[model samples]
Target: MADDGLDPRRWAALALLCAANFMVILDSQIVLLALPSIERDLGFSGGGAQWVLSAYLLGFGGLMLLGGRTADLVGRRRTFLAGTTLFLVSSLLCGFAWTGGVLVGARVAQGISAALMAPSALSVVTAMFAEGTERNKALAIWSSVGGFGATAALLVGGTLTDALGWPWVFFLNVPVAMVLLALGPVLLSESRGRARAYDPVGALTVTLAVSAAVYGVVRAPETGWTSASTLGALGVAVVAGAVFVRVETRSAAPLVPLQIFRSRRLTGGNLVMLLTAVGAFGTSLAVSQYAQGVLGYSPLEFGLATAVLPVMAVVGSYAAQAMIGRVDVRPVAMTGMAFMAAGCLALGQVSENSGYVTGLLPGLFLFGLGLGSSAVAAAVAALSGATERDSGLASGLNTAAFQLGGALGVAVASTVAVSRAGAVPGFRAAFDTSAGIALAGVAIAGLLLARPRRRRVPEPVGVTMSKEESTCGT
Candidate 1:
């Protein structure tokens, strides 16, 4: 470590971390294109095949907070290595599964491993870089890499499934996980929180609550929002959430410290993240359905056509990081949301006979820009105020907000799309809904983040660095 407490190998550590992050995120969606192949090969009946996807989502979304807290308690490097090993084993198991049930089981294990890796890797990144421009740039790269992973999944999944069969999708992770496991111990340092109280009660309740909520949301569209199973799952989530709150209030060492919520930027950043995911994921679903279903494009063609989104997102991430250094996070985030809304509105106008250039490219371009920019801004806002001790918890909260928001987005959009009169009309309605969500994000950013102004003087004597420069780079 340097005099500034920056890790000497921070950049290399970041690359390893981002690679792990990308692999886990890639697995999340890579299986989407392979679902049909999986179903046919494993003799899945009816909608049972969807479980291969849902099982992973439930485990990942549900266990993320626990996983992050675990990193803080057990040591980030250790947790990361353990997670990678499990992920490797799970991926191998998924590739070799002879039955649909076995594949789904392996997928759940993969999700668990992802839950461990994501926050731990992120917290490590936050720990390695000091909270300023360096961290901001690192996060920009991190956000852009995640965007690429999601987009790559669509393209890679199709190609791999077509060429090498669907199992290759799972097999792809084996090599990546092996490399991470090999390099992790060498590149990363061990770090854990001072507090040692496990708070098992709080942990259990929060996990149950989040898991149940994710389960309810993901299943709502298929099971019907009013269905007993859906209502029951949501009810369990509510009750568990209530219990978790109560437990945290009285626990000697809380799973999530309630005091952390006092940070206005942290709270607001999380809300922005949630709403951003709502717009990003929901609108992507709408666009993908429109391109492939109505436009008569094959899976590969659809992926290639929509590739512009991730490319522009990469541009936007770097641009937003640069902009944030000059101004408050508010303007950049609000502008990003505005762009997203505009993109959604444009896509909403798509017709049955619309072409890619005239209909899809423009909207995707704007949405991608917004997606990348807003993501960086939100992450910066959420993580900047965190003390080193609470870094993992903060990272977990941010990641959980995103995962939950994505689940909500996909559910709401699917519900709206299916309830409409026709395919085109349904997709249009979904896009419009996504635009509304983006607009809501704009309002949240404006209200929560500081207004733009010229650079102010440095902090007064005795003030800490973290408290003085709280609003991302502002």
Candidate 2:
């Protein structure tokens, strides 16, 4: 309602935005299957290797809230274009990177671009599509692209990594970027929110603090908890975080508006998002290692093993498509959460030597099925009440939560694995822990996402508004 001026061009622009989101998500997974090769080629150790993912998460998650707000403050179209440019340039750098450090740095750059672009894309969609059936369909497709993109990344990444080498994973993003950039400027119209002060201090403090903490967690696998590097990083994270909170409270422009946290839907939905992210991250990262290390598969083989996960995701998304108006989003999300928990449990118990035929494949399929449905439900549920003004913030916050959950999952699981001292027992323990976390995620959703149903009816508009506003505000 805030920006009632909807243009017919918006539809084409949203399609392009979804395409861009697909590319960004693809990069998230494309290099994952190739990580082993890259590690061998670059000589990175276990903890050191995680930086490949952690660095990207750090940049993407760290600045995400600020980036989204920047889109609101500036013009969404310009921000989207700028982010695409950055992503393209960074991907080229990543492809060319010779050293582990160079690659990690480039990954950071790519994450920054993702942080900037994704929220704008989501926010643009929110502005373009009117609420109700049309918006639900659009968000469904938007969310599904993310799931499908991850799936495509596996196939594409495997082919590229096998045929052209791991660097090609990054290189692949360049042409896609160019295409999005060209299509975007021609198609997208400039859109802005209420002008607000830019919170440089708050943004920097929060980003650096989170980055430090994530670094500590990611590097913990390599650097012992007692190591100076880990301790110092955590300390920096603490100090920076404290300062960030203080800055946001006093600053005229806050990267995250404290008031938005007041809503139960916003807070609860974010918790669900964060947990789901952890569940999703742990599933993907751990699965690859389990597939190759335990099951004796190659990178391409491992990638193929995951094909079912994405496939299931698409199925789940389609399922949600049919249910949008027929159901409220909470129960749908809860069902998806239940599936994810079940999948995690199945995976945890799966025999180490199990092939896709006997063990891994079934679990992977379950994960895919569960994840696909859950992701769509979460996006819609989270954005249920999003308005044009706050869409960027809400989208950004959800994204930030997801990214942070991913980083946290890897960090925690790796720490557990390392604490087990890299033995078979340790790996098993780590997988068990991952499954437990997923259960915890399921429990959280069961409690928060479902219980709110009692409150949904008396205030349908309020509930819906909560979802919409939460998407924008969070």
Candidate 3:
């Protein structure tokens, strides 16, 4: 054990960080299942109810870059603690919310807090773990933990909403957040990225760009994709994005350095994250809809049935972690994409007469497995060569990709599904499209994630490489 308390107990620190990440994931998903219940209790009008979710998405998706950069500017431990405190307070506020407006406001607060908490916690993981097998394993576990949080919310949310009321969903996060806050100081050590002056222009432009893009994507399903509102929002995103790039070029201390794009691994990993999120989130939506609308599964039944997916995800994550130690990340990621494609393809078999056992089970398992594997691989690859200075940015960028991808996935899948002859057929169409996206990811993994080969120097006569030595770096 080193003198630093965190070195010897790094895994434990990972657990705490992952727990924070899990809370963020859980809060997002848990609210989904309880939306109906919340609306009824709060007497929310039909159109207004959507704001509960949209507000949170806006806050979270838009501010991720700012949050990550803030972590880099401040200290990771301080950011984590501050964010957790805000999240805790917001969760409490959500639980006590008597009106729809209050609840939505609280949710936005939670989203902002999460935007701060997530990148800091993840960057801490990269900082603590050395970039090798240990980091790979830690990332795998982190991915698995998030998977469990998402899946668990599906089950737990339904149960809580039915039995204990919708407030319990938010209330549950309070204790968990409190526990993490209490333990974190003792269990974790403080760390900061390279000190740099804040880039207000870069932050402002990127925040507006991302927030507008995500808002447009989220609204497309409700508002026509080509509607004036949607088009205007998208136009704003494009303009803002362009301005952001220009700002970064001129700024001495850009929030996200332009040089990060030069690394194929970083760029590829983010793209892969985006593509896989499209497949995974789209499939989850399809599965949920199919189970309830076509197959007539109750909320509880749907939750129970979908529970198996997370179990498979855990197994897949562990498998990926073990395999990553011995192989390149591209193959692992490609293999995961293949599994996702296969799962989506299998789900294309769903029909009105089909049952859960035959129709959804196989696809669910495969999708979960692929989700777990690819999430870990892509995350590790995204942060592959990151130092402390850019670690937070890397985390924030990956998270933003995931959020944007999920929004686009849901919007596109829903649109495609509805455009077809019937709901069931539309779902199948969406599943097929998701499979196509996953297949695209497989190709991208090959093209973008390939490591450059190193040229071998001819060894002197009688000289030999060690048993494990290779001509090229893995």
Candidate 4:
């Protein structure tokens, strides 16, 4: 496409990228279904078991900026290949892990690999497809794949854990990733951004800051909020964040150029995405636990009960794509967030005796629709006007927002749940919290996203406007 001579079949390459992305996202959810089983077999107790999930989130979210920057500096193709390979290896290790510590370590490796692969994959798609209708369709399909990954995990996890045991969930990725790797070299094209010196200080400080902050949040429930360990980690995060800001301002080649914030559309989009994630991710954890641990549904039944989400999500994704050319993303995203908040509020009303048919199904349907719609619009907003050079960074920032929001959401929801009365009551409390966060997102979308500009401002000759600056009228 663009005379790159690397991937002549652009759509085929896109399929490969989406598949790899699906593999990574699927791992994140599949583990949720298997968590109870993992606890029983591996002798994990209380919050320690959360490390299996948190360890992955920590590495993935913390290193995302560096991963995205690296994709820009090194070739996207090279980084994708290396990252996918590492993911495959780590998945294999996770399958064979004998202890909680080993599994968590392997999961951390998987997260790091994903940080590299996910952003590069999205950037490559942007490079391959031209902007406008074609790009919108590609992104819609990309987001739908993510929805499928998240929902399909419940079904696949239940089937695997029931039939072949929990280890098979991890083992399943090997073959899928292997097939992707085999096809990657043949179908994918290579691309890179402007050459610049690496900013090691900025990268190191930012990663540490994110890791420390996530750790402090995750541990705050077990250790009191004011505990020395919690406060110390949070303090480290604050200092490191300050250092990272200083490094970026001074460095000739910054890991993340502060100028990116000049784009109001991107900044607002990321904020909405972060807030939406707080609702969606936490709801998933709370609901899954309720279905299995409280309701006493077997793994397979749990899958069947929640299977409606992905199906509705597909409908919403296609609907979003159809509306993209005609409607501004601001309204679309706002409506989506409103639906999410409504769904969470409805689900939060659940009682111990509430059954799947009356209590869960209605809210699940709404949540899925909102999830698909919000994901499509948020992704479009985040990447709306990026130039070729900064596409990878923009993609990385969007993904990092989602990951970090998820980690924080889970921590907050779990903490609230732990402090509440019983399992069901605690879950309801968490759902209420999720709804509140989604409402906050609605406020942001309403205030921050300007109505789309109807008329274009003329520029002087030889002074061309970059797409990033012009698209959102920022």
Candidate that would win on lDDT: 1
lDDT of each: 0.87, 0.76, 0.83, 0.82
Summarize candidate 2's per-residue lDDT along 217-318 as a digit string, tens digits: 677767777799999999999999899888888987677766666555556667777776677766676776677777787777766767778778888887
- Stretches of candidate 2 off by over 4 Å are 1-6, 40-49, 225-228, 418-427, 450-474
Predicted candidate 4 versus true structure: per-residue lDDT over 1-474, tens digit per residue? 447443468889888999987887787667877787898889998757768877888878888888888888898889899999999999999999999999999999999999999999888998788777878888888988887786778789889998999999999989988987899888887888888889999999999999898888778877877899999999999999999999999998888887776667778888987886777678887888888888888889888898888887777777788887898778888888888888888889888788888999988899888878888888887787666777788889988887778777877887888888789889989988888888888888877665545445553222112443554443
Per-prediction backbone clash count: 0, 10, 0, 0
Candidate 4 to truth, TM: 0.93
Candidates by lDDT, descending order? 1, 3, 4, 2
Best by TM-score: 1
Q: Write the per-residue lDDT of candidate 1 for residues 75-99, one digit (tens) a residue.
A: 9889989999999999999999999
Candidate 2 lDDT (Cα, whole model)?
A: 0.76
Model 1 RMSD to the real structure?
3.1
Cα RMSD, model 3: 5.0
Off by over 4 Å in 4: 2-8, 45-47, 451-465, 468-474
Please tell me which model should have the higher TM-score, number 2 or number 3. 3
TM for every model, in the order presented, reads: 0.95, 0.88, 0.93, 0.93
Error of 2 at 418 (Å): 4.2
**In candidate 1, what residue range of length 10 has the lowest lDDT sum?**
462-471
Q: Candidate 4 at 151: error in angstroms?
A: 3.3
Instruction: Please identify model 3 stretches exceeding 4 Å from their true place.
Output: 1-6, 454-474
lDDT of 3 by residue, 151-182 (tens): 67777888888789989988998888999899
